[model samples]
Target: MAAARESLLDAAGAALARRPWPAVRMVEVAAAAGVSRQTLYNEFGGKDGLARALVRRAADGYLAGVERALAGNGGDWERLTAVAEWTAAAAQEDALVRALLTGCWSERLPAPPRGPAPVPAQRRPEPPLPSPPDLVRIVRDRAVTALSGPGTAPAATVELARSCELVVRLALSCVTAPPGEGGIAGLIRTAAPRTAL
Candidate 1:
């Protein structure tokens, strides 16, 4: 079942890369994955559900990369600076990451209408897709933990965490709108960890 789900998500992702989300049909995704339409619907519920799952998968991958960046060698500042540089490069190279960072998608078509049939008054609206800020918070929390790891005094942990948050915010800002020549490196260098007051 998990393999089936993965296969469908992979197919859906491929479709997304080639065209807008609205044009991606579940039947086509099923056909692409060699799964039945029922299997696709059973796994993802609907197009909205599939979209959420796709975004979640991408977000998870991005966060995993962040974990690697935070765990890389050198002091906190150096690791964070590396991550900032990485984020900038990734935003330019990957459309999904760019969409996650910028909350704007060049390839995403307009979302389809709620449903073909009218909704019941008692039925709740579908859950909203995870917001871009949610992704930021996940990265920030991980960074705080990474920044505060070993050798960090308990007293300084809070301030160090705040620094991590700032670093993440700045990196995200760079992703949203790339800096001018030499500007990104300067941003990262300036964000380097300082002694917590």
Candidate 2:
């Protein structure tokens, strides 16, 4: 079953690569996968479900790449550089990642507006939007893993993790940004504090 699900996802991704998300019909995906429409629906409820799964799968690949880069020999700076470089490259190479970053797919198939149409609500509006990408949490988790070991200094470990996070986020932003913008190295110098040096 898992293999079948993965096969469906692979089919979806390949289709997406060839055309815009809006043009990608379930029937086409089913045909490409040699599965019935019902089977596609069973695995992924609809287009939105399939898109979400694609994004999640891409994210998993990115995180794995970062982990592999970190595992190689280097100090914090070198490892951070590796993570940044790998992430940028991955984002560039990944169709789904580009789709999410640019909202190319989501914009093509936007969700319907919430609340009653042509009716104003009396209740207070919802809270402000959340920040992008939850960098703090990702950084903290990576830092803990990288710094926790025998003979590792607590302060240095924290610093290294902080540096890594800064570099990684910077790289992500650059690779994901619209064309004509500069790369991650520019963002790194600006975001990382002097104390982090």
Candidate 3:
């Protein structure tokens, strides 16, 4: 069932890439996924449900990348640079990620649902896609938790959070108006405060 769900989602995502979500057909998605239409419905409930799941999955995937960048070996600022770089790059490569981060959902992409679908398969409803500000807060909090070494002072933690948010916001800026020569890392280096995250 999990495999079918993933395949269906992948198919839906691919179909979305080719055309607008409204134009993507259940039959084609099921065929592309090698699952029956009924199986697709069972996994996602319907197109709206699938859109919600897609947005949720994109958020999860982006956050997972942030975690990896934060967890990997690096100096304090380097870890944040990695996260910022990933943010810009992911938004460039994935329309869903870009839309979620920028709140500029073009007609080509799916507008996230208002709320969760009452799908039995969902068990628990997936959280709505984070707004851009929500995403900033989420990323800032994650960076603080990951980078705040044991027993850091609260004041220091607050300062570190500020640094982290600076990096994230700079990355967001890069997503909207790309940097000129040195790319996002250069932008971060120039714009980031003397303190590092």
User: lDDT score of model 1?
Assistant: 0.72
Give the lowest summed-lDDT range of ten residues in model 2. 122-131
- Tens-digit lDDT track for model 2 on 109-177? 323223322211332333221123543355446645764567768896677667666666667566756
lDDT of 1 by residue, 134-153 (tens): 76677777777777757878
Off by over 4 Å in 3: none
Instruction: Find the 10 residues in a row with the least total lDDT in model 1.
Output: 110-119
lDDT of 3 by residue, 66-177 (tens): 9999998978888999999999999999999999999998888887667556675655667667898999999999999999989999999989889899999999999989
Best by TM-score: 3
Please report how far candidate 3 places residue 165 from its true position, in Å: 0.4
TM-score per candidate, chains pooled? 0.78, 0.70, 0.95
The model with the greatest lDDT is 3
TM-score of 1: 0.78
TM-score of 3: 0.95
Off by over 4 Å in 1: 105-130, 150-155, 191-193
lDDT of each: 0.72, 0.62, 0.88
